[model samples]
Target: MQGPARAVQPDEVLKDPQLETRARDLSKDLRCLVCQNQSIDDSDADLARDLRVLLRQRLVAGDSDAQAKQYLVDRYGDYVLLKPPFKTTTLVLWLGPLVLLLCGIWVAVGFYRRRGAAQGETEASIPLNEAEQKRLSKLLANERKR
Candidate 1:
């Protein structure tokens, strides 16, 4: 009889159901190195299957969830974990957007200040000439009538 296709292959299942469950959960948080975007649990790649076996082995060998995940991280350089720990290597990934936003704001503020300076020299600080003042008054009078 054919059995169901499983994310955790039948042969890789641990004798202890509890440990197998832990392995399954851990697998969901592990990135498949081959697929890049898929978790080991969801990937059908050979590398993902190997990772699943390795995870089950680790759990059966008495490693806690954190220790098992750390073991994979150590072997694969943190890229194997879907959510990598915050550290020097990932600092830019964590802070890059905020840093870019601050830089943009600083640049925009400087540009605005320069624009204000240019505008000040043009007409912002100057009194209107008599002809311009008379034209403005006539326009205002026409607006009041409307």
Candidate 2:
């Protein structure tokens, strides 16, 4: 047998399919105030249910989705939007990935350039000193033995 959720969910049959569609779209884009990581559409929290009802009421009262969302944003700030508008205030959030990507590319290029420059440097023309010659001879002997 199914659980209690299977009953209450079906009981709230949306009278208008268009309203239901709009509600789905709006809820999916709205972050749940209680469960900050979840959208209202995906949250079972009481606050999520309340927000759903509020959105439906606003829609029925002829408020477009944008207006309803703006109302919520005005009340709760941009955190209410799961995907907020890319404006001056949120420019860091919008451009952060690209900025990080460019930095990574620049660092990689710098590393490669440094590596090439280091490789281009000439090896010492002089022979190894006494201690260095002993170490090198031991190392060569070990390698040959291996």
Candidate 3:
């Protein structure tokens, strides 16, 4: 016996070639949330199966390829799409890495500045006044004569 209800085969889709192609293309780009890395077409999870059925129903109902995909997005949010659109809603998802990079640079700059300041302090020396220099030289000369 068959392992389970198998997918509608590509060969069997010859009756409606355009619909089959559209369904395939859309399913491949859509994600299976139940199986994170797997596309809707590839995953046999319940959610993926539901999406597959939904795709076929929409195709048969005369929704254009884009329209059907958009319909799913409307129901599930852009998270349903493999590559979610970049929008204000998704800005954090898209720009998270860049924000982290900028923060790291800011921290590094501050750390470097503080380290430099510490080094300057550690190596700092005060210059003597003219009177102090003269007194030091005279003391040295007196010691030498002794």
lDDT score, candidate 2, position 79: 81
The segments of candidate 2 whose C-alpha lies over 4 angstroms from its true place after superposition are 1-13, 33-38, 44-47, 122-146
Please tell me which predicted candidate would have the highest TM-score against the true structure.
Answer: 1
Give the CA lDDT, 0 to 100, for residue 74 in model 3. Answer: 95
> Candidate 1: which stretches are off by over 4 Å?
1-6, 101-141
Could you give me the TM-score of model 2 versus the true structure? Answer: 0.61
Tens digit of per-residue lDDT, candidate 1, span 1-146: 12323566778777776787787778888999999988998898999999988887888788999999989988998789788778999888679989999999999999999999999888777899999999999999999999
- The TM-scores, one per candidate, come to 0.63, 0.61, 0.62
The predictions' CA RMSDs to the true structure, in order, are 5.1, 6.4, 9.2
Best by lDDT: 1
lDDT of 3 by residue, 112-135 (tens): 999999989876766778998899
Q: Cα miss at 120, model 3 (Å)?
A: 11
Query: Please, what is the whole-model Cα lDDT of each candidate in the order they appear?
Result: 0.85, 0.79, 0.81
Candidate 3: list runs displaced more than 4 Å: 1-15, 105-146
Ranking of models by TM-score: 1, 3, 2
